[model samples]
Target: MGNLSRLLKESWTLVEEQQDKVAGYFYARMFLSNPELRDLFPTQMDVQRARLLGAIVTAVQTMEDPDRFEEYLQSLGRDHRKFHVEPQHYDLVGNALLEALRTFAGERWNIEYDQAWRDGYAVIAKKMMAGAAADTNPPYWNAEVLAHERRSRDIAVFTCRPFYPLDYRAGQYLSIEVPKYQPRLWRVYSMANAPRPDQTIDFHVRALGAGYVSGALVRRTRPGDLIRLAAPMGSMSPDHSSNRDVVCIAGGTGLAPVKAIVDELSRYNRTRWVHVFFGARDRDDLYDLADLNAMANKYPWLTVVPACSDDPGFDGEQGNISEVIARYGPWNDHDFFVSGSPAMVKATMRTLAGLQVPSIRIKYDAFTDG
Candidate 1:
């Protein structure tokens, strides 16, 4: 590509050999220098270090491929916006990274190599700054939860005091806090309703096998639960100005964010051409069908498609939501929004890729991991 890109490629060739120590030193140095950041991380530093190491390796690998490296970096740059990571954070990280490299390189470490690494970090920081500025980003914890509702066994909706007084653009989420079995447990839930300042936002939480907070929230929490919360996050909202066709695929409580998105579309009188595919088990286990049905009837622009994987009476569609999308055919023109269990999100994303949808247009809200 260019001088910086070529330098990046050349330096990264040594990454595979030094990957483990690079990540190790980076964290060890950073945590030592700024002990405050320790609270931002999981309690188990070793485990979290491994995770960061893996993530760094993956990121470096992606950068090695020049085809769409900028686009991928831009996506990560956008993601960091949710954390409210600033330019100073990058500078701090870069210092730690270089120190780690120097320690690992030992006698071999030279000023020239250090300069290259510093230059690389500066390039990435500049790009991240540009992306942060252009994205119209907001703070991570700027909103408070006003109210919530229990729609089904594992699905609940919460109303939020928006950081900006306006309607949520659909498919967005809020980071929230709840009593945790662990030392610190905070999670995110998608808004199930359109932006309604006077009312509560909605969230659908599917209890995983042993989801302590989710189970308690679904089974125990009530109207006036004093919930700790962050502002709305995620970039999966639909653009109202564009009439490009859209499809939503959701499973379990993944429907919460999808429903919020659909509700937003309905408010703009843009529902008819949109198709929503929701998958679940039996009738009793199904969530928000009634609300979705009412929306469909109210707006000619929308179509709700529910699929049951196990219900014998499921007369509409059978199998996974992604499968339903495939059978319908011609998804090239439509943007795909996927949410659900990690497996469902992963599988549906694969299916969408196989169907040839542009990566940018295919969005997902990973609800379970929070």
Candidate 2:
């Protein structure tokens, strides 16, 4: 397994920088050899290309741990049902992937690397197949946008309800397909609220970069707009059994999952304290502070602290959230859940590390933005 892991990781290092070329080659080969499979994907190949490469990256990441790797592959397989992926398609993709890697890996590629990836992909396909077969849930659900509110120039809050109950944990993230976008194009968002009897989901979207789905969701979606939601996947739920208190940090729309976990904690918590640090660049970006205050007012065990890095007029914690956290007592002993843009999460993690927070005590959704 060690040699296999080394060979896999080494192969990735050789091609990751040239991923665009690799992805282009893989897809071109597939469409050229099996044109029928082209109908299974979206008209715009941009999102599909990134997703395929991302899936391979994820698979390689988990290769070190057999159980974790298998579980991830199975979950991925279960999720891929939404794409109508078949067993035969897996073989098709595997061959294209090998060809792509070999072409880009150049002289560094050897029989050992080829055989390792082949064996690894076989296990990956088998596990994914088993997972898809075991799932009884629909590949996706038709949802109606119940409400849409533009909180800022680039941000929107949407309330949507699936036609059927969408069973998911409080903090899990789900991929949503919008009718306004290309057919079958999907983007992931954290469900901002805990499950209600009504089963409505709240999504907070902010247009970042050239975020295609975020732009569509923020600017174009309207009430009564129909959407599709794929299965939920994440593991950021709170541990109620732990005696330690909890500290949740969030920035921008990353507040979704942290808020859901806190909302979930409200149902089971008795004595544990929960401290929430919500931060943004300016006052307008801290859009959920009022709502968080309302939650804090209702729950005696929860505390919400608002921070603004660029708002000089702000009377609250007027610094980066990571800096504000330092003023509070060292929460190194508390269970930590952090979410936000990848950059914000990275800075916060570095701060937590400096505060002597044990790695095991920290948790965050590393791939929410990916």
Query: Model 1: how far is 18 from its true place, Å?
Result: 12
| lDDT by residue (tens digit), candidate 1, 23-81 | 77788889899887666665535434655445343444555566445554554565566
For residue 268, what is the lDDT in candidate 1?
A: 66
- In candidate 2, what are the lDDT values of residues 1-370, reduced to their tens digit? 7787788888789898999989999999989999998988777786578678778778878888887787778778878889899889999999999999999999988998899899878877888899899889999889999999999778888999999899988778888888667477788899998999998999888887666777889888899999999988777878767989999999888898999999899988988899999999998998777889999999999999999999999889988887888789678679999988777888899999889999888888754442
In model 1, which regions exceed 4 Å deviation?
1-29, 39-92, 95-117, 123-154, 162-168, 179-185, 209-220, 270-272, 281-285, 310-315, 353-361
RMSD of each: 5.5, 1.7
Evaluate candidate 1 by giving its C-alpha RMSD to the native, one decimal.
5.5
Report the error of model 1 at residue 68, Å.
11
TM-score, candidate 1, is 0.69
Model 2 lDDT at residue 4:
78
